[model samples]
Target: KQKLVPRRRVLSRSADLAEDYRITSDNVLHLVLKLSDLNLITVRTTCGQEIEFLVDRYRNVISLKHHIFQEGKGFPSQRA
Candidate 1:
């Protein structure tokens, strides 16, 4: 599996968000979401021995912000 580190902090202008970072790995894929004034961009990639990145964008942003519901998964569990 590959790990996706959020890069939202490095974004200055909406145009700068129109880039994609590649992540090549096993059965796992990371989808990075970039928001634009009119739409959103989703960059899907995998991870390898070492992480890699590429410039890419999506067609819609609203779809990426959709609620992700996971069954049987409650809020963070309290530590004992």
Candidate 2:
């Protein structure tokens, strides 16, 4: 039997654009943010720059990382 890998659904604009990375207002990711355990995820770059994102409890760490990546924000290599 061949190995099977799950493919993540890619978000697009107007159901046509596939690989657009620009974060526009209409293409912004709308994650569920008002769950029981809402948390603010803050990412700090090497140069002391910080960015914040709101995520709920149900999302896994990988999903958070994926979100950051999907939004074209770029993830930090080292954790602080």
- TM-score, one value per model: 0.17, 0.39
Each candidate: how many clashes? 16, 0
Off by over 4 Å in 2: 1-35, 71-80
- Across residues 4-78, which tens digit of lDDT does each residue of candidate 1 receive? 343333333344333443323432433456554443233322321222222224423343333211211343434
Q: For residues 1-80, what per-residue lDDT tens digits would candidate 2 score against the true structure?
A: 12211133334334544334444455545433333577788876665667777898788989888866765455555655
What is the lDDT, from 0 to 100, of the residue 26 in candidate 2? 57
Against the true structure, candidate 2 reaches a TM-score of: 0.39
Which runs in model 1 stand beyond 4 Å of their true positions?
1-25, 40-80
Per-residue lDDT of 28 in model 1: 44
Q: Model 1, residue 18: what's the lDDT? A: 32
Ten-residue segment with the worst summed lDDT in candidate 1? Answer: 47-56
